[model samples]
Target: MTDWNGAALEKIAAAEELDLAPERPNGTLRDPVTMWMVRAGHRPYVRSVKGSDGPWYRGTQSR
Candidate 1:
């Protein structure tokens, strides 16, 4: 899809499409958080911590 001026309109369409993506429930952007952690002397490896009292908390849970 090209504009009236014969310019390639691919960039404009892609930007609008990204804006309609699903929302994140964390109330903050994940990408920025990951990047900041990387720059702040944090290790690249990560893991999840949870309580085992509930039935959902199993020892074999996977990321």
Candidate 2:
């Protein structure tokens, strides 16, 4: 897997949110969902406000 570079990580750290579209089993992207992002050290993390029950989160599981 490709890792995030320093510049990319820095840009992500400065952002408050991101749009995610998980790919479906048929290899198509689902609708984009806007969610908050958190930076812990050099790592970035995100979650749905509705937790695992969220449609976007559930979409991610399909892959």
Candidate 3:
């Protein structure tokens, strides 16, 4: 099975289930998956290294 967390699902779902109307606003942009990660003390995974993950950029090493 997928390693997805259920409580996170509930939180995001609650936001999705809001009954906003034409004259009303939607809701919080803070998605539960994100918030859950935050509450769990997790961080958004880095997408990729901008350049090299080498210390050379910081003047600590040579290429």
- Give the best candidate by TM-score: 2
Q: Could you tell me every candidate's TM-score relative to the true structure?
A: 0.16, 0.74, 0.21
Clashes of each: 0, 0, 0
Which 10-residue window of candidate 2 scores lowest in summed lDDT?
A: 1-10
Q: Each candidate: what lDDT?
A: 0.26, 0.80, 0.30
lDDT for each residue of candidate 1 in 1-63, tens digit (9 for 90 to 100): 222222333333223222222224656533311111111122122222223442223422532
Q: State the TM-score for model 3.
A: 0.21
Ordered list by TM-score, greatest first: 2, 3, 1
Against the true structure, candidate 2 reaches a TM-score of 0.74
- Clashing residue pairs, candidate 1? none
Regions of candidate 1 where Cα sits further than 4 Å from its true position? 1-43, 51-63
By lDDT, rank the candidates, best first: 2, 3, 1
Q: Which stretches of candidate 3 lie above 4 Å from their native place? A: 1-3, 17-63
RMSD of each: 15.1, 2.1, 15.4
